[model samples]
Target: MSDREKLEARLVWERPEPASRPAPEPLSREQIVRAAIALADADGLAAVSLRKVGASLDAGPMRLYGYLSSKEELLELMVDAVYGEMASEGPLTGDWRRALSAMAQRTRRAAKRHAWFIDLLGGRPHLGPHVLAHVEATFAALSGAPGFEHIDSVMLAVGTVDAYVLGALRNEASKLERGMNQAEWEAVSGPYIQRMISTGRFPMLAQVVRDATHPSADVVFERGLDCVLDGIAARLGR
Candidate 1:
C-alpha cells in the first residue's frame, strides 16, 4: 500500500473479524499479539515478525494477516497490550502533583519490566482502548486542579510529564541495551575521566565528580520527578 493508504488504514481494533467461520485451528488476534510480545520480550522488537509470530502459533504468516492487516497493526496491538499492563498498576490518587508523580513512577516500572516498550513509545499516538483509558486517567488526575483550568493547560502539563518520563525511560533502557550498567561505565571510563579531571581544566566537572554523592537510581529518579512537578506547579502558579 502507498504511504497515505497505510496511514489511513483501519487499526486492528477497528477492523471486523474475518467474515468467514473461525479458522479450524482457532487463532485469535489476542493470541497473535501475545506471541509477538513474548518474542519481543525474549529478544527485542527486531526479533518480532509476522513469520516468527505465526511460527510461534503454529500457523503460517498469511494466517496472521487475516487478523491484522499489516505489521504496523501488530505493533499497535503490542503497544496497546503494554499499556494494558501499565493500567493494571491501579489508579492514581492524591492531588495533582502526587497523582502525576505516581503516574510517572508506574510508567517507569512498566518500562523496566518491558525494555522493548521504550522502543515503541513516542513513535506514534496510540489510540487503543487501554491507551485512551490511561490518558483519561492522567487527565482525570488534573481535571479540576487549580492550574489546569483550561484544556490547554491540562494538555501542556501532561505532555511535559510524559516528555520527562519517556526521556528518562529511554536513557535507562539504552544503557541496559548497550550492556553498560553504571558499574560497567565507571569501570571502563573511570581512569580516563579521572585523568581529565586532574588536569584542572574543568573546575565544575572536577568538583561534581569529586564531591557529588551519587544517589541510587531510585533516589535520583524520585528527586528528578519531584523537580519536574515543582517546576510545573511554579510555572502554572498553583
Candidate 2:
C-alpha cells in the first residue's frame, strides 16, 4: 500500500464498511483488542501478536484479520482502548491548573496500569476518538486562561504538562521493570558508590549524593508536577 493508503488503513474509524459482510460471529473487535491488551499487560508489547491474542481468545489467528489488518492496526486499537480507560467523569470546570493536574494524574495512573503504554505513547499519530476527546478536554481547560487566549498558548501549556508527566513516568516505570526494590538497590550500590566517592576526584557529586534525601516515587512525582504547574501559572500570570 502507498503511504496514504497505509495511513487510511491505520485509522479504524475512517475505514469504509465492507462491501460484503461475513455472518456475525461470537467475536468482536472489542474482544480482540481487549485480548491483545491482556497479553501486553501480562507480558509486554513485544509479546502481543495475532497468534497469541487468538490463542487467548481460543480462536484461530486468521479470525482476528477481520477486525485488524496488521499488527500496527492492532497496536493503534490497543492504544485507543487504553485511552478510553482514561475518560474523566465530567468536563473540565474552568480551573485550568487543577484540570491539567488531574489529567496528568489520570495519564500516570493509566500508564501504571498498562506499563506497555509508555512505550507506545507518541509512537504514532493518535487520532482515535478517545485520544481526541482527551485533547479536546485539555484545550477546554486552558481555553480562557489569562495568557492562553490563543490556541497556540493553550497547546503549549498542554504540551508542557504532557512532557512532564511522560518524563516522570519513564523513571517510575524503569524502577518497576528492573524489579529492584529501593532498599535492595541501596544495599547493593551503597558500598560501591561510597568507595568511588572516597577517591576524592568527585567531591561535589559525593557531597550532593550524601546530603540529598531520597524521596518516595509518589513524593517525587508530586513535587515535580507542582514545580511544572508553578512555571505554567507564572507564565500565565495566574
Q: Give all candidate RMSDs, comma-separated.
A: 2.6, 2.6
* CA displacement after TM-score superposition, residue 19 of candidate 1 (Å): 5.5
User: How large an RMSD does model 1 have?
Assistant: 2.6
Query: What's the TM-score of every candidate structure?
Result: 0.91, 0.90
lDDT tens digits, residues 124-234, model 2? 568778889988988988887778889998989899999899889988888887778878887998999989999999998798888988788989999999999899989
Q: What would the per-residue lDDT of candidate 1 be over residues 191-225, giving only the tens digit for each residue? A: 99889988989899888888999887788788888
> Using lDDT as the measure, which candidate wins?
1
lDDT for position 188 in model 2: 90
lDDT of 2: 0.84
> What is the lDDT for 217 in model 1?
74
Off-target runs (Cα >4 Å) in candidate 1 are 1-9, 19-24
What lDDT score goes with residue 187 in model 2? 91
